[model samples]
Structure formats: C-alpha cells, structure tokens
Target: MNDHCNRCVGCTVQECRHHSDCEDFCTLDRVQIGTHEGNVTMDQCTDCKSFDRR
Candidate 1:
C-alpha cells in the first residue's frame, strides 16, 4: 500500500485495488463520487467512481 493510504477516511470497499489490507484505508488522496441518474435521493445514491477491481 502507498503511504498516503494512512489518511483515507470512511473507506469500506475492501475489494478495491487501492484499499490497504492492514489499515483498511484508501490510497488515493481524492476519490471521485457519483450516482446513477435515474432516481437518486440519498447518500446511498452516491458511489466511489475511483473504485478499481482488485
């Protein structure tokens, strides 16, 4: 994992390639957030666009 992963916040996607195994933090300093365009209305509507398949 990169050293920057230590500063990650609220990361839960353990399957992502950028996610650290030990600390469970994301390596990216910034993560792209987005949502489907149909009927989004809550925080659950958002998704981490930065996710990459591990």
Candidate 2:
C-alpha cells in the first residue's frame, strides 16, 4: 500500500468515490461508523455510514 492519506490506514472499498487508487485508501477526512438500532450483537451489524458511491 502507498502512504496513508487523511486518516485512512487502508481500504479495499474501491467502489467508493473517495477511494484512492494509489494506496487503496480512503481520501475522506473522516468516516461515520454506526450500528443498527435493533439488536446489534455482531460485527456485521456495524456499518460505514460515510460510504458514498462512485
């Protein structure tokens, strides 16, 4: 991976519009992470609310 830009250490979400090709890193300054309201018990329940389409 290339240098970490913004706060992203690394990312594989190439579909995101803010994803950089150089390092496979997210260029966004920050990301919003959240969990579902009803019965959040596992890692699958968490979501990256800041993901935008390319």
Candidate 3:
C-alpha cells in the first residue's frame, strides 16, 4: 500500500514551512504512481502535509 505520512530521519524543521507547529505535516512514507509489484516507493514531498499542489 502507498503510505503518505511516514516521518523521515533527521528532518530539519528550519527549512520546512510547517515547522512552526506542524512537524508531522511534512513527513511521508511512500508514494504510488501506478499499480505494480514491489513498485511502491517514498518521495520527499509525499509526506509533507504543507505540500501545496499549486
């Protein structure tokens, strides 16, 4: 399954926009682009709750 809330190791809040009061908002586990065997992977922006799609 594709998870999008896994926390990253040594994530610095200074560069994060949600660092003020939402550290967990900028963390992800994995991102799924298509359905495939062992094709699931995590991305840098997937976990970020503050990730603006604009």
Highest lDDT against the true fold, candidate: 1
Better of 2 and 3 by lDDT: 2
lDDT of 1 by residue, 1-54 (tens): 544564646686889887877676888778888897578888888888999999
Assess the local accuracy of residue 50 in candidate 1 as a C-alpha lDDT between 0 and 100: 92
lDDT (Cα atoms) of all candidates against the true structure: 0.78, 0.73, 0.39
Distance from true location, Cα of 32 in model 1, Å? 0.5
Q: Which ten residues in a row have the lowest lDDT in candidate 2?
A: 1-10
Task: Sort every candidate by TM-score, greatest first.
Answer: 1, 2, 3
Superposed model 1: Cα runs more than 4 Å off: 1-8
Clashing pairs in 1: none
User: What does candidate 2's lDDT look like per residue over 1-54, in tens digits?
Assistant: 324466544677888777776766777778888987688888789877888888
List RMSD in Å for every model shown.
2.0, 3.4, 9.9
Q: TM-scores of all models? A: 0.73, 0.68, 0.21
Clashing pairs in 3: 6-28, 6-29, 25-49, 27-47, 28-47
Supply the TM-score for candidate 2. 0.68
**How does model 3 fare in lDDT?**
0.39
